[model samples]
Target: MFDTTRRRTLEWLGIGGAASIAGCASQAPTAEDTGASTSTAQSTSTPKPTDTDRVAADPADVPDPISRSESTHHDITLTTEEVVAEIEAGVTFSYMTFDGQVPGPMIRVRQGDTVSLTLENPPESQMGHNVDFHAVYGTGGGAVATTAAPGEANGMEFQARYPGAYIYHCAVTNLDYHISSGMFGMIVVELPEGLPPVDKEFYLGQHEIYTDKGVGESGHHGFSFENMANEQPTYVVFNGEKYPFTPDRYGTLSVEQGERVRVFLVDGGPNYSSNFHPIGNVWSKGYRDGSLEPPIEKHLQTAKVPPGSCFVGEMETPVPERIKLVDHALSRVARRGLLAEIDVAGEERPEIFDPNPDTAGSEDEEGSAY
Candidate 1:
C-alpha cells in the first residue's frame, strides 16, 4: 500500500521530469561559512552514571500538537521514548522521539506567559535525554535545569519573554545523534496582539536520518555514528516518513484557492540546512527565523531554515494547483526522500494560468512557435 501510494504521487508530481520549479534561491549557512567550530568530542565533565530514583511518566501521554492553554500560566510535560518504525516501504529506523513522534509536539504560548515544563525519561529508554528551548533566556536554554536520565523526571519554570518561533531538542552529550534520531520540536510564542489571521495553518519539521544501510535499501536499518559525524544522511524527510504529505498517503495539506495559508517549519537537522521553497507559489510574507518584527521580506521565493531554527511563511493561492513543498536542494529530492504537497482545490482561473494552450492551432506564429 505504501509503495503504491508513494509511486503514484511521485508520478503525478513529475519527479522524473523536473524536481521543482525555478524560484528565488537562498544559501543556508554552514559551520564553515559562519566561522563556527564543529565539536566532535563527547563530554566527559559530567559525573559517572549512577542509579537515580524518580517518578516515571508514561511516554504515550502528551499534549496535542495544536493544544494550547487559554490562561497566562501553562504547564508542559514531555517524555522520551525509543521506538522502531518504518521510514519507507521496507525501511525501518529506530527513532528516539519525544512523546513517541518525530518533531515532538508543537508548543504554543503567549509572549508573556509563564511556562512550567517537565522532562521525563522513561525507564525503557537506554540513554538520558533533556530539552533546550530556544525561546528560553536562561542557562543552557533551560537544558541544565531539566536534564534527566532514564527513570527520572525534572522540572523548571521560565517566562516566555519574547515572541517568536523557536526549536527545542535534546542537549545531551551526543546532541547531534539525538536530534538526528528524531528528538526535536518547536515552540511558538505569539505576540500579545497575535499574528495576522489566516485561513489555514500547518506545522512541519525537516530532519535527516543517518543509517548504515543506503537509501531505499529495504530492510531494518541501524543508526550510523560515522555517517552522522560526516554529515551524510540516508533520508531527509518531512514529518517522519517519505512523501507523507501526499493525497494517497497521510493526505496532502488541503486549502481552497484564494485562501491564505501559513506554514510553520522547524528544521531538526542535526546536519544539513533546509532551503525551504514552495514550488508553484510565492511567499507573500516571510518571517525569517520565526521573527515577527519589522523588515519582513515580501514575495520571497525561498528562505533558508537552518538546523535548530524555525521559519514562518504565508501565501495566497490564486489558482488551483498542487504546490510541491521541498528543500530546494535538488539532490535531496531526487535521491533522498524529501517531498511534500499542498493541494489547492477550487475553480481554475484561465486568465491566470491556461491549462490547455493552443500552440498548434493558434494563428500567432511568433508566440505559438516553440
Candidate 2:
C-alpha cells in the first residue's frame, strides 16, 4: 500500500509512467528496426532499494535453548572461486561458488553438534575471503579469521551455540566487498530430535548478482577496476540463479496435494530485503528464526523476511496450483533474479481458490531485462 505523499511524489517525478515506458522501449531490439530512431543511451539505473521484504523464524520451533546437545560432527567445506554455472540457458559465466551452487549447500545440523568447516576461498581477487557464523558469541564468530589467499582455507571449530536460525555471511566489510562479491550463506540449528518428521525440506537464500557471473564477493571473477567503484548490480536471484533460469522444465520444487511441506528459508541479503510469497498456498505457521509466534493464519499475498535472518514455513497442500516463490520485492520478481517455481501437480478441489482468491491486480511486472 502506498501513501498519498508517495503517490504524489511519483506522479510529479513520473516514476511509474517512465518506468512503464522505459520497460517497454527496452524490448525494441529485435523487430527489424521499424524506421524509428532509437536512442543509444541505456536507461538510467533505478536507485538501489534499501527496503524490500524480510521474515523471521518462529520461536515455538525452538524447544529449549539450554537443552542438552546430542553432540555430532559434520564437515562442511566453505570454498569460493570462479566456477561456471548455467544461470541462463546456453550462457555459462565464471561464477564464484561453494561446492558449486550459488547460495552454497544445504547446511543443516541438529541442536547439539560440533561443526567444523574448511573454507577454501580460491584466489579470485587479491582480497581475502573468510567465514563468519553469527552463532559464535566470541572472536566475532570468525570475522577475525578471514584470509585473502586462494586455496588457503579459513578453517574453524565451533559448536552449535544457538537454537534458532542465525546468519552466516562474510563479515569483511571493506566496501561491503565480501557480500557484494558473493561470500555469504545461512545457518539453521534444529531442535533435538522427537519433533515430527518433515515430509520434504529445502534450502534457499537471497542475494544480488552484480556481474555477468553472479553476485556477492563469492563470484568467480574479480571486479573490473572500473566497476570496483560502481555499485549498480544487474540481477537478483534466489539460491544464486535468476528466474526463468528455473524455467518450468528446469528448476522447481515438485509437490502434490495433501502433502505437508517445510521450507527452511534463510535470508542473507546483507543489503536489500526479501518478501517470500508462495503463490496458492497459505503458510499457516511461521517460525521466526526458530522462534514460533502464533502462526499467521490468514491468506498472505506477501510475507516479509529481512536480511540476516531465517525462518521455517509449514504449508499443507490441499490442491494443485502453480506456486511462485518470489522476493515480493516485485522488481526482484521480474528482474532482480530471486524467482523460482513450484508446480503442484495433482487433482483439484472447489475450495482451493476461495480462501485465497487471486486478487484483482497482482500481475507481476513484465521485462526481458537481466
Tell me, by lDDT, which candidate is best. 1
Best by TM-score: 1
Tens digits of lDDT, candidate 1, 1-370: 0111223322432333211211111333233421222332321222223221111111122233333434388889998887767777556666788887777888888788899898887766776667889999876677656666666677689999998989998875566777887899989888777777888788888999887778877666766666777888988988767766776556777889999988888899988889999988988999999997778899989889999899999999999988888899968877887877888999979889876676545554453210
True-vs-predicted CA distance for residue 258, candidate 1, Å: 1.5
lDDT of 2 by residue, 285-352 (tens): 66755443344334544567776677667777777866677776677776555666676777767665
Number of residue pairs clashing in candidate 2, backbone atoms closer than 3 angstroms, sequence gap of 3 or more or interchain = 39
Q: What TM-score, to 2 decimals, does candidate 2 have?
A: 0.66
The Cα error of candidate 1 at residue 129, in Å, is 0.3
Please give the CA lDDT of all the candidate structures.
0.73, 0.52
